[model samples]
Target: MAPTAFLLVFSEPGPNVPEDEYNDWYDNEHIPLRVNTPAFLNWTRWKAVDGEKPTYGASYDLESYEATKKAPYTTLAETRSDREKGILANIQLLDRRHYELIEPHPIPLRHSTTRRNLPHTSSLSPEEDFNKWYHEEHIPLLAKAPGWVRSRRFILKDCGQMGVEAQKDQKPPKYMAVHEWASMDSFKSPEYKAALATPWTEKVFANVVAKERRVMTFVRKWARL
Candidate 1:
């Protein structure tokens, strides 16, 4: 089977609209429209933790680049256009990124991970804290989890704003960390649980990370190149 790719979209609530309303619009209209698209495989949504303002995330999976590229125009261009007109019409666009799945070793699993833009904050000490914890601690821990598979990270240089304007008082982080898990169940394994429960996790997160948002979903293939 061809590996799945993920399209991640990140954004903050608009100036005049309320977060709840935006979320409702997404759940009721946007998601349905995307799923209804011809090549769309699966979708999911998540909210950011520690975010100064509400942060929303969505994930879309397609069989292959060819399928992904062709599906929207063939199946749901009209629906997508309508959705863009409503929810995304006036909202401040934050970030968008495309990710290709990492090939798993030993196991036949396929998955990809990507990070949208991240906001900057004075309290966020990326050099001494975030980077250290992520590289030294978090990555290693996840690697040790059950069904451990190949993983990769990417930094989106020109993705867009990441809710920084909502909190004008703080500076946004220059980088975002993206992690790929072989399977959702693997991430939920006992080893993973213990890793996150450790003091190291607490120490790493202490005062550095204000919020985090994540979403997971299954993928389907429409066309392959």
Candidate 2:
């Protein structure tokens, strides 16, 4: 069976807009509009644990690639367009992207994860250091981590008009990557603990990423056909 995928949006409204007001608009108005759409299957919202700014994360899952590819966009498009026209008319308010599930290697259950690294903003300069650690060190170590099946990584290219600007010219992030896990408990495994204890993982933290990073996690929900 094909796995469900989500289009995620993480946003921080304009400075003048109160966080509660933004949350209210999203929970009361925007999310309901999207959920009512034929293409949207499930929706959820979350607040960030660490940010001083009022942060909001929203997710929308589609039944399948074919279903998502064919859904009516008039209402969806107009709603997003109008929102952009409002408080976010000029500022880029959030990180947005689409994620799909891939088969896990050794495990029977499905697993999902996505990673996005901000360019130039990362504390780890000369990204090659981070790259080497991720592919050469981190992945190999993770393979031994329990419940880790198979993992695939992809470079996010342009989403065409699906991006915030709706202009092909507006480039979002310079790079994006993803990792898959067999189950949520995989993180609690001994192998994963050992991997985190490794020197490579430590170096990655001290050298690559800045204190601030944007990470999002989601649970896959198989949509009804």
Candidate 3:
């Protein structure tokens, strides 16, 4: 199936830059420019109410995989202005991740899709076998909820780590899973809770080293479909 990809950026302010200006550059300048692109269909910004390290996050839904690699998108980093360049220097941490939709072929999701970023450092079972169980066993069960629209899994693509500083003691998550729901209210249903209570879910949850989750709604969406 053709996938709906997301370009997600997680960032925090540098020691010297003003918080308000940093926000303006992202909200008013950077985000607006990218959303205007033909490939970028929708945008949603979120604040980290639960996690540490990344204080802010934004996700842009792509029309296609080719959109991310094509002109304008590819040239964006190289074409940064002097003001954007200065802002880049002052940003302390920037982590970028790409995710592509993996489920509900034929029927497209219509509302907020819950984004779950999970990285497993170790597991009781072998790494290869662990993923096998997730796709065949875990994810299928979780999507059984009434509001569960669809789900997708993503692998990290190595690119543009320009200003990022990797920690010697830790590494980024190897996989990210995006689950779509008809609405936020769908998450509270009894069916959703039951799906998560399965034994396979318990086993997988035990081995996760670090995970980050964020809820987001589209501010603006542009598309042909």
Candidate 4:
């Protein structure tokens, strides 16, 4: 299979960590170890433009949602070098979530250099209406916006604790919508606003229990060799 699931990692270097060293470790050691696995397809990283604290986002394509719990992937932590462990200790992890694709676009997404990440949870019981509204009305209108490339929706399958010691049992929102853009300008365009301003959009959003909006800009991408 060509990666039907992904792992979303949110983190940032701690105040005491040097930016140069942190980036070097991430670019050289941290990402490479995971991408080297056969089940880990590709890795793409982004930085938040919304001025949020845990300012980094990384998405790792996986063979399946179960891939993270299996051999090589699960064993990587035990194989980490002392330096890698030291660097990771000083990093502040925000959230680590695993999601399986639920909305498959007619046009496949080749690459997304710029995008908006909307992770949310619904308050509606059964969530049938919420899912219906998103698939039927919401995405169609957003597709009308200029510079639209593709959209993807995923449902959370699991959550990882990482450095989140306080909320050991806490979980993130269950649904994530990743909207690809040709450029950031598309987000502020009139069509985009029109799509979001619709009555249906307002109605569905009213039932959203939790949500986080992140405007992401590309940092780098790597794939298995």
Best by lDDT: 4
Cα lDDT tens digits for candidate 3, 54-144: 6777766777766778787888878887878988876777767665654433334435444332211212334566677667776666566
Between prediction 2 and prediction 3, which has the larger lDDT?
3
Residue 52 of candidate 2: its Cα lDDT? 42
lDDT by residue for model 2 over 120-143, one digit each (tens)?
A: 111343477766766677667777
Candidate 1 lDDT by residue in tens digits, 1-225? 443555566677677456777776777666676666545566666555433444666656645545655646345534455535555556765555555543322323233443222222122444566556665666577667765543443332223334434333332344444444545566568887876787766776675644443533322221211
Candidate 3, which segments miss by more than 4 Å at Cα? Answer: 1-3, 100-137, 144-150, 159-171, 180-190, 206-225
Q: Which residue pairs show backbone clashes in model 1?
A: 49-211, 49-212, 50-210, 50-211, 119-172, 119-173, 120-171, 120-172, 120-173, 121-171
Model 2: lDDT to the true structure: 0.51
Error of 3 at 214 (Å): 4.8
Q: Please write out the lDDT profile of model 4 over residues 142-215, one tens digit for every residue.
A: 78877777777788898865552325687777788777677777878999988889887788777778776777
Residue pairs with backbone overlap in model 3: 102-152
For all candidates in order, the CA lDDT equals 0.52, 0.51, 0.62, 0.74
Q: Would you estimate the TM-scores of all the predictions?
A: 0.50, 0.53, 0.70, 0.88
For model 4, the superposed segments whose C-alpha errors exceed 4 Å read: 107-126, 164-166
Q: State which candidate has the highest TM-score.
A: 4
